[model samples]
Target: MTGVPASAAGGTGAKRVPAPKGKLGAAAVNQASLWNIANILTMVRLVLVPAFVVLLFQDGGYDPAWRAWAWAAFAVAMITDVFDGHLARTYNLVTDFGKIADPIADKAIMAAGLISLSVLGDLPWWVTSVILVREIGITLMRFWVIRLAVIPASRGGKAKTLAQGVAVGMYVLALTGPLATLRFWVMALAVVLTVLTGLDYVRDAVVIRRRAIVALRVAEAEAGAVEDSGASGDSASDEAGESAAAESTR
Candidate 1:
């Protein structure tokens, strides 16, 4: 239920997750206003970030009641993250703003969750650091190679996001005994997936970037060859005309 939109996924990966059903649908979605339901859902997630953070720290940051409220806020944000992308794709409500804002909202909430947990000493700093670096680094990598090609989201990427959301959500609450130990293992798996998926993205970006560069060079070379051929023909025609004129004058 919680994941990044394929459209905005540098981490989620390239090629929109749900393909527009038809050409008309695609066109309509592209032209949809920024204020559509999908974009609004994204905006809602953005607003919830601060609300979740505030609630997380309330009542000395350890009160179960306050943590429950914070978890509610986080849950709402995650729920909206899912609905926004689905509605946008299914109803042809996609917009440029949605594409840009959706992922940002996703990252913002995750960052808030991780940082707050770390700050409260509930989660270790290194765990948060590793995940954040992967998330942020892959995000930056997406923009870097965007002009060349989009990297499609792999199954691994989806798994990574799910593991992360579940892990973080578990941590958001005050768990005990078996549940607490379970969360640690889940977080461990999330970390592993995070690192593996990150390396995969790096490899894909490099490959795609290389292919784009090679394609561009080949196109340029062919165009230059065509121009050279045209020039040679023009020069021959000119010489022929001059010879004919000289022969006629003689």
Candidate 2:
């Protein structure tokens, strides 16, 4: 027929669905190129790490004005940190680059701030050491278990980040009296949350790794069973063929 058949375009039978126009765009976004907004924000934070250190140390490293400017840079980094993650999650723009670079950026800025304060005698060395160990250990653990599964950031982890940021920002500034004491308490809270969340992450990693191992064993068993069944069927077919040939010879 000159016209397309009814069953082909509009019929009660199976029909071809037209591809959605936005499907490719959605996939590209979800795949999240390195140039995506989230990753770009993460890069900005990383770049700010060095800039913050330079600004913080300007004017003999004790100038309140310079520290204030350093604080501004840090605040911008921290704010972008919040938005990048939100955008990635909300828009399905998550990517491997974001996963790795995001955490690294977070650790770099916080680590720089903490270490700088410690060097300046503004913060205790023990506080910086404890936090650095925990942060580095958790980051490594994430990579260790990444092949099996991802350990998502917990609520406690988020709280810890906020507390650390606020406490460190306060430390970055020149505070005294009640405000300085308040910052101490805030940092104490951050430390507590850091240790607790670190333990939680270890637990989660163990559980996820165990589950992954179990799942792998189960899959192997299933595949072996399937292979054995197919082999037995083939053997049965061979036996039947031999019996038929013998009967035909008789």
The models' CA-based lDDT, in order, is 0.91, 0.91
**lDDT computed for candidate 1:** 0.91
* TM-score on alpha carbons, each prediction: 0.86, 0.87
The residue pairs that clash in candidate 1, if any, are: 13-153, 14-151, 14-152
> Residue-wise lDDT of candidate 1 within 12-91, one digit each (tens)?
45664555567566557555577777888899999999999999999879999999999999999998988998888777
What's model 2's lDDT at 115?
Answer: 98
Candidate 2 has a TM-score of 0.87
lDDT of 2 by residue, 41-89 (tens): 9999999999999999998789999999999999999999999998787
User: What clash count does candidate 1 reach?
Assistant: 3
